[model samples]
Target: MAKRSNGEGSVRRRPNGTWEARLYYEDPRTGVRKRRSFYGQTAAEARRQMREARERLAAGAPVADSVMTMQEWCWRWLETTVAASSRRPATRVLYESLVRSHLSLPPLGQMMLGRVRPSDIEALVLRLRARGLAESTVQRIFIVLRMALEGAVRDGLIARNPAALVRPPRIERTEARHLSVEEVSALLECARGTRYYSLLRLIATTGLRKGEALALTWDAVDLDRGELQVRATLTRIEGELVVSAPKTAQSRRVLPLAPAEVEMLAAHREQQAVELSRVGEWQQDGFVFTTETGEPMDPRNVLRAMTTAAANAGLSDVNVHTLRHSAATAWLEAGVNVKAVSALLGHADIRITADVYGHVSEAVSRAAMVGLSDSLREPPRD
Candidate 1:
């Protein structure tokens, strides 16, 4: 038997030759009695562990509680933290879907959050690879998990963030394809009589993203000034269309409309007015581009329309975004400054514009040298 210290508790030697140590203290914050215990073959080891436990509790560290599973914490993390962030709605929906459909399964989701190790995350990534997920998607999952675990650490629910120790899969960049001048002309000619003629012309002339184009409203268009303001975008989230702020602050830009594009948009507006009047009870969304009933157009539907228009135009497999690339490439070929192009495309940095359009400029420079040589070799015909 051992005497209790200051009426706290005792470390006593049991009959089986093992020592039992118990401590009881009232929590300062909760005012509730808290108890802990340690067992050891020696009283000294038992007392040491017990003292360490008490110190840990006094330091405001989390005691072992009900184990929080990964699936449980992930839902709470999404609902309570991620859903309230300034991220675009599409991004939030994608994160939620990725967690639910892929991450919350089997050994990974069933594991306790506190007990999750780096090896577990690495294994999850490996499993994703084996399951044929793209490296980019796997990397995104890693990022989402890292963010969720970081939130847990910030909330003081976890002692350490295991995600910090795991490495994300690497992704390789694929080269973007741009269209030729003749191809752009042919595509524009094909869109001449279609319902989306103005929309196609606008995108071909300006390098605005698909979302930016869809979110355009009549208020953002200034025909008098020959400009269009890009302040918001329409994106699909969980199969629902949502209008939200642009992905980047730089993405909110004003693009100058070509003369032909402005005239085409004016004609299209008149046609849309007639169509809206015909459908008296249809939804009247204020979108610049809409379905016949004035409802917002689905982006995927627009993509399909673009594809059909391209095929009809005698172009093979040219995507809608290729129109934007063609616009940038054409401008670069015509001696536009990279900085101006960067501003037109709403790129965060001029380096991005240069990286994508630099080759076109190089070809232009080569042609310029050829022209200079031809002029010098004119033989002074006098």
Candidate 2:
């Protein structure tokens, strides 16, 4: 499909330090002439905005102008930009969820984009806070709204992002939760007969992200060398499982495994073989972990197993992530360098490791004191 040729758009600088680009087009279906406008902070931005709109028209997606309602703009932006971008599947899902649950509400849903004000966005934030939404959730809603309107600016649909002008709610600080060593053992014991037993054990010991563990394949494991590589992640998009590259370059790393974990994994492979042989329709997917018929494991199934195990063990608020944090905390408490811990966990930045695991555990505190005393020891010759 080709974009119908549009009239040459005009760009002009406004008196208020903003730029405007305008074009006139005839609606093909209605045979009515209409004016479309785009805006930016500079003449070049305005022109680029206009050009992108034309490209979208060429691709057969109509650009909703400023006259359209906020709801219409949200829907259009989601389909034309967010859903179509190169962003992660997780991110796309988050944006879509926020739009449906919050942005589509009455406050701004029916209001025209041209008439939206900073005050309107502020009201939405206040409303979300008043309704007892978590500070994190309220912050996320505001972020998505800002991003959606920024998409509007890029598409030349809105002159500015009002949400940008409005102050977003402050996000409360939080630390990752970790389980005690005894709690970890009890949970594993409870999960011993379950499908995710080995998986939970692997993550608790190795701190592997749930997605990374679910996507693991036999080829990535080196039992003899006592190492494994994180090469892919598993995610569900629109109800279908998809395997994709690691979220960051650092996420694709080789990690050393303990001898016990290696032995456990070897045993797991033997058991898996026995289980697969009993199923006549094995898919031979080669995943290190799989369903009984050899299909890739679903993350939801893993979560279910963890929830059941936690309940049985009398552990509260425990999930796959709790196991990961526990492993990191264990490593740090063992006097491992923060830098080494950062690499072991495939953290993109060392600061992320420091921030999440910065809280001092009793073991870490004692180790620190012992190390300090040794460094301050008197010279024997004196």
Candidate 3:
């Protein structure tokens, strides 16, 4: 066979009937002729892969040795990169689960890192969707995969991130569930005399997230001044409770408390003092919401209690987050400044507040439309 030109690789059929394309190049250090081969079921496919490899080489992208599998690089990338990042413990756990359980599955994991193509990623998405995973879940998986592969690119393990070229599954935006003011009243009534009563009321009035509310300490609360400082959040990581900083720097802000909330907290504090005296040696965790022993309230217990309260109140599909949603909706409808609402909700930006709750106040929107229409119309005669 005649020798091919420098840029043109040679394609040939093997005895096993598979096609292979070979690219001959000089070793940069040794100046010795070396060859790399790409195999495919068809000659055209192999040739195309070889052409891509040649282009990548011409562009100065270092080709990693073919011995490194996707699984190997992914694990290395996770251990040395993602695990060392400053993300929350809960977030790190989720990332770890995605890599260990989903990304390292089957033929994809066994393939060479440099040989992973966009079609492989697309197929993975299809398989996940077929397995009944939600679109949002699949999208999250893709995010982890893309980030890990980006690390690979940065590490010079791969010339490019194939996952970057594949589109993530789209998720439909659904309106967040919230209770009405009357529903909130009913749920609170059901929660009355229970340990979570004060906690539920605080969340409903202040719009704090479940974790943020659970993470509160007495030192951060000022009953006399009617203020609550959001300093941290509580999350469950690997079956253990983890207290971490707020989701963002902006999430750690001071929120004004209503007069009623101040009174409720004062009474709760007195009640706690009584309970502490009875116990004689309380753990004194200093959290605003705690068990009878003064330890931080377990979020799971709170969730269960909230679920029961919601059921008793005759509200369907309500959860702890409903308290926050209800507060945001009520405030927006009451004409509170969007920026104020954003700050109160601890959202990183006002746009998030507007996007989530802007159209949720249907009654307010209707009233504004009617007022505008009436103003443009002729007034009633006296």
Candidate 4:
């Protein structure tokens, strides 16, 4: 039997008793012939959809005829979109690593890009959680997946983004531990004469992130004005250290230094000058913090020094970042405004400061309650 050939489309009954109308057209982008099938419960409905599809294709509009797989689209997005994007090098590296290490796998990676549904992504999240992955890691994976799918949507490979329909797992917030005034004093004392003494004290006093402090140069600091400028941060990428702009615009800030910190920095500078003179040559980069060889100290070395000092001071569970948390908590307890503290910490939002240190300062909360009780007390009639 000869099959009926329609100029526009062909209608046939599928095995499941449904009608399918397939329209053949040439893709405007690739100039290649492609076929798109429209299914319906009835032949009339199928024909109607096929007519619409034909009209769209004739008008140079794209039809859903892509056979690109998820793996293919993901790689394209990574190489063309993510790689060519204006994202920071560190961020690009992180996204690339996440896609290569986690997203490229069987069952999900090999699936058709257009066929990925919310259930498929949710299943991936569940599987990651079952493998004891952290909520933040799971969320990062989902973020990369969503961004890739967003690119596919932009390119008309899929009508809608399935990742947008599914919710990533919520990250659990952990309270940061801060040291007490006495404990801070003891720790700084134990760190006295050590290479990390000034670095630890600077972080404790100004709340500068370890990377930011390590990346600082003498040019960014105005010792006479007692101000320290934060413009860039040092981060390790692919086992190599790189200095880049702060994470956000708000992170670039000028922080005031305490008088004692200024004096300490002045002395440290003089000491560095002597060390450089003895070495018979000056280091080109005038970074405030460096090794005896006048080279930038590795952040890991600073952390190890801090940890050893903390152990000597009888402090438990204290790391390099504890100094930063301690500063914020102390400022809040001292009745400093949250917004001021937020700006001092180089936080992009005041709400982040509130969320992190607002309720965690039990001493401040207790003082507030005591003051409220005092105000509510009734005066005795004389």
Candidate 5:
């Protein structure tokens, strides 16, 4: 046994041959008594561990606590932390779905936050991959988990976030499908007699998204000017149709309406008037696209109508969005610049327009080459 006069510590072996050391000091900030212990079979080992503990306390390093589990911290994090931060309703819903569906109750959540290692995150990702989740979805889950643990680190709950040390799975990008001109014609011809035929034609010609088309009002259309104003979109939130601002600042746009489309819309408006007349004192909403009862058409119903029209046209697999792509392709083929096409499609950037529709420009280039060949031909000397 060794003891220093200044109240520094030493280890002593008891009669039972067990080595133990006890050290007492006052907390520098609060002047409270702080006691620590080290136990080992040999006095030397106990003394060494006691010295390490004292050094760590002096350095203000955190000691790992076995009681602090990931599950506990996550609950506290969601309640005390995330609840205080303002997030969009849609974003909050997505976060709740991810946490409840994937992360809330698990061996990973049960493990102490400090004890969780990078290997644990890797194993979790493997499990997600085995369950048929796409790499992108698993990567999103990893992001949510990392953010949650990072929050814990900031709050002094954990020493470090293990999730940050793991790599997320790589995601594969698939090219978007666009309809050919023939396919577009076939689809339009199939929609001929159906109520939504004009709607499909409008989508194909004007490149209006389904939401934008559904949100159209009679006031926004200028038949004489051959233009339609896109100022809002009908989107479903919490299972109810809500009219909201355009998806992006640039999404509000004016689209030219062909004379034929104007006529079709005129006839459709007449039909809607007759239907509204039969409603007998019902309030009339001035939406250009609506149900027979003069109520705004649900975007889902518009999609279904388009799907049925495509099936009748024998283009069973074509989605409503394919019409928007077809319209962009048509404009590109007609020599519209990528920037002009980007504006027409309400894309945030011309690069997006070029990336998706640049292939159509190849036809324009071929036509130009033919024109150059004809103009460059040399006349006979005579």
Candidate 6:
């Protein structure tokens, strides 16, 4: 008998000149003790396998066998680690989409859990790019694969994460499009007398994200204080509308209400009240924006409303985000402090504000230069 000093595992000669190695451990997940065995033709080979298992166990890693396929491990990881965790449903939905559409396919998926090599991971990236997938999408797919393999490492299924050794595709950042103040005002006016008028106007005035605006509740608004708090966001998760906390801590914030928005909201509230009165108990509450039936506004309908208004206003390619950017652009161009604008937009960092509205800053600088030159010019009478 060749026994480990810790008495956790042993290698022994078996019947008919073969060798068997055994490691005993407690299953943390199941809370039960279990035994795992390995076999080899030579005692030395059996001992080596036994030693690897013991080392993994000593390192606080699970001693599970790596016989599962990559596809199997990925699903297990999704169901147990991602879905079962405390992550938002939207995050889980994204992970699910990525795993199903990319990780659980073809040669990589069918391979053994520990069989993936760095080269195989690199080839997957190349194949995805060959299919003409956007670099961002390809980068996202690679991240899902990497996350799956990292789970495998934790479960003792693989010693190294091959995806970690591969480089992901680089993503190019495109400049965000936004409307000018005049265009935004025209869009708002076009949407006026329509149900989405107030919502669109609010976004342009406050730079609130569509989700954050839709998620706004009566409790979060203070008409007297002329303020509103962004506490949650309403988004679709797996096709079901869900109200969840803001995506980032900075996203949960308080914003001052411009006088125009305050008046707009007051009128909107009155209109909403009249509409809800007719709903006859089918009415839902706690949402600032709602459907005719008083339910939370479906995100799709919100888009339709916005697009219709944009088309009528002769604004092409305007989306919900355009309004937010338009508001930020207006703030930057009007000489508001960049930091103040960033806080108003609930940005995690001021740099993000500067990046998106960098053009606005340049324009502001040029205007200031003109003003300075004019003021410093010699008087004509001199």
Window of ten residues with lowest summed lDDT in model 3: 58-67
Among all candidates shown, the one with the greatest TM-score: 4
Candidate 2 structure quality by residue, lDDT tens digits, 10-31: 8889999899999766654466
Q: Please give the TM-score that candidate 5 achieves against the real structure.
A: 0.70
Candidate 4 versus truth, CA RMSD in Å, comes to 4.2
State the local distance difference test value for candidate 1.
0.82
Clashes in model 6: which pairs?
A: none
Query: What TM-score would every model get versus the actual structure?
Result: 0.82, 0.79, 0.85, 0.88, 0.70, 0.83
Runs of candidate 4 with Cα error greater than 4 angstroms are 1-20, 24-62, 280-282
Q: lDDT per model, in order?
A: 0.82, 0.86, 0.87, 0.86, 0.77, 0.84
lDDT of 6 by residue, 46-71 (tens): 88888887776777666644878888
Q: In model 6, which runs have C-alpha deviations exceeding 4 angstroms?
A: 1-65, 371-382
* Model 1 ranges with Cα > 4 A deviation: 1-35, 38-66, 314-317, 349-362, 365-382
Worst 10 residues of 6 by lDDT: 1-10
lDDT of 4 by residue, 1-382 (tens): 5543323578999999999998877676787767778899999999999887766565544576357888888888988998887788899999878888778886788898878899999999998899998899999999999999988877767767899999767886666788998999999999998888998999999999999999999999999999999999987888887888999888999999989999999999998888988886555787889888777778889989988889999998999899999999989889898999999999988888887785545666788899999999999889
Off by over 4 Å in 5: 1-91, 109-119, 143-170, 281-285, 361-382
lDDT of 1 by residue, 1-382 (tens): 6543322767899999999998876654465767777899899998987777666555654443228888998999999898888887788888889899877898989988889999999999999999999998999999999988888777656667899987677885554578888888888888777767677778888988888998999999999899999999888776788899988879999888888788978887898888877886777567889888887888898788788888987888678788998888888888787799889999988877776665644567889999999988956666
Better of 1 and 5 by lDDT: 1
On a 0 to 100 scale, what is the lDDT of residue 135 in model 6? 92
